[model samples]
Target: MSVTAPAPKRIELSLPALHPEQERILRESSRFNVIRAGRRFGKSTLGRHVLMNAALQMAPVAWVAPTYKRLTPQWREICATLNPVIARRSEEEKHIDLIGHGGEIDFWSCDGGGFPGEGRKYKLIVCDEVAMLGSDLERIWTRSLRPCLTDLQGGAWFLSTSKAASSYFTQMYSWGQGERPEWKSWQMRTADNPYILPSEIAAAKQDLPAAAFLQEFEGDAVSFSGSVFTNLEQAIVDAPLPEQYERWAQQRSWMAPETEFFIGCDWAGAGRRAGGDFTAFVTMAKDGTICAIERFKADFALQRVRLAGLVSRFRPAAVLAEENSIGAPMLSALRASGISVQGWTATNATKHKAVEALALGFEEGRVKIYDVENRAVLLAELMSFEATSLPNGMTRFAAPSGGHDDLVVACFLAYLASHRPRVGECAWSPI
Candidate 1:
């Protein structure tokens, strides 16, 4: 008689049932949903539960986190929840059975190679600690994951603790905050997790720094203490194009005759990636008000020439262009072409002092920015700006990774070069 194959066994998860908030998330069918909760609040536990449910229901799922190194513990925790029969299989064999049976979860990390090609369509995706993922991760989800989910009636789930108020995570939170038919949001604090002991909360409060306690335990988006620009929200204005420029110009025109105009230039190179960013040429009058300006963001030389033309028309009192690498070449080319430009050495002292001065100016409401298409990028950088203390006890503002401070740097240089106490008489120019 021929031997027969043993039947495959079904594995049941031994975890507790979902809580009210967890059940709410499970019932949600929105295309996008975010779960903002503190640690030990059952966010990841609920995520794993949902993944198992999707698997049992014959839905493909992907579990993504910031990095594989950080995801190992989660994987082990999830595996521990699995029945012994499934957990005993070799890793490779286990994946095969999981996919074939339709009760499986695949792991992905933002730092890993692109999405897996497992020959199975994915119906659900769970992103953990989303705040720690790089901004480009959003593009990955939009470009690759979104299209892959087309046939599965799939949805993406995001779980993260609150981050700085302007980070990628915060932006997603804001996006989900709006009334949209396709999105849902749920938030909870450490206090909401009954599993956490009261003594644990008190201990965290006593041990962790104030900002850390507020962020991790309270789920609050508080700026770090010692931040130079603590009241950054007030500095932001929602002025849209041409109108913002016109209004700013009118304001500058009202200044005294002796007021000097300063233009700060941060040049971009000649490569495609480089061309994507403009040669940011920002103009500011002596009263710390931004006046006329040009941002040459496109690739063609004609755009640069047009930008140069705008500079000529503005006739700023002084043009301070950074003279390193591509910037030096661009400045030389512009000056050679009769653009009366002055090269400002970006020494360590000058750069440091410039940023400090700009911080003071911003605090004092002496600086203004014209409304433009690039305001979002500039504002994000400004809001995320942090101050680091040196051994000499000096604090310097710098952008965090995934952040851009080119405009901020240019503005600082402009302020440093033109800053002077308001005198009785100032020259005013119309551009």
Candidate 2:
């Protein structure tokens, strides 16, 4: 008797339920799907659904974010969601193999300056927060990832809130709606999400600047004119420390204990209310190297505890907190914790001095920052800062409407503290 071979076990795959808007966009027959949505409009969730569903059909799918660090959370979620149907997962390569679909979803970062989906055929590609990927986004799509889709006739989806009207994201959105016959687009606000409260949006509108409200909540690409700092990109040390710094620092290991650390603090409002400003702490070395930065929104008392912990870890020579509003209390609280904290009053003159110093640092290549792609808000603030000239010939520096400069201010403080003279330092020149 001849025995027949057993059939392969069927693996059930189901797409996650999506919101009505998400479903509508997915239903579009266009090869390109573009969405310009307000913040909190469920863009990430929709992207997840799109990638997962695509994997069930024709794949390997590709998900691209501005940076690897930003893509990490989504990568974890995708792995967890498809764990049951996953055949293998390569964390090192950020690749996943499905059980029965012959499908894989790989995550890539645009910040690495390489073609993400090169040489690989993809059935679907999702670019989350494409606006933050910078100006070369068009080349990334048309030159790099688009060719990968040719073999499978795969589709591409672009998702982001408006960054600027002149940005590649807005151009793509326009092309998707009109210029491209194979594309479709959708624009929606946070209000469209029934899960969000109307009062919350109203409060946001009131709190945010007019242009910021329009861009962030109204899905408009407002122009960024009169920006103060322009050389942020040139100053960013995206990868490891530069070889020059490494060599010099390695030669100076004899003075490790003498190297003073500085901390700059920007205290958030009390009550730790939702949507409040952040308490940013920037730590730097005496040599003007930014070591680390942390931002939090919590109660003043709680923040002090956190500060104390950081103080012990950093062993800062001096902690400078902005001496305004809740900052005064926070500085005192930190000092009471036996930390060497000081209050730095933020008057117009002092703020102007600090801001100019920071701008000069970036311009002169004296200050260096890391994790530019991951720490987006900080980088954005540094780039979007603007200075206005008053009728009296005075200049006021601040972040554009709807943006926070807490990180920038904290960084400025760190930079300022880095130059302070240490005890037993000579006042006369060595020469």
Which has the greatest lDDT? 2
lDDT of 2 by residue, 1-431 (tens): 99999997777655567777767777874889888988988888888888887886647999998888888999998998888888899999999998776688999987765556688999999998877765667788889989999999998889888764566777788888789898888888878777789999999875554555666887776543454554667767767544443343334353564355678888776212235788888877677677667887777777777777666655676777787777676766555555666678888789877876766676657776766332677787787787653322234577767778888888898888776665432111111
- What would the C-alpha RMSD of candidate 2 be, to one decimal place? 18.5
lDDT, each prediction: 0.62, 0.74
TM-score of 2: 0.54
Residues 8-54 of candidate 1 have per-residue lDDT tens digits of: 65655477787766776678637888877777777888887777667
For each candidate, how many residue pairs have backbone atoms clashing (under 3 Å)?
Answer: 8, 0
Checking candidate 2 for backbone clashes, the offending pairs are: none
TM-score of each: 0.49, 0.54
Clashing pairs in 1: 256-426, 257-426, 257-427, 257-428, 258-426, 258-427, 259-426, 259-427
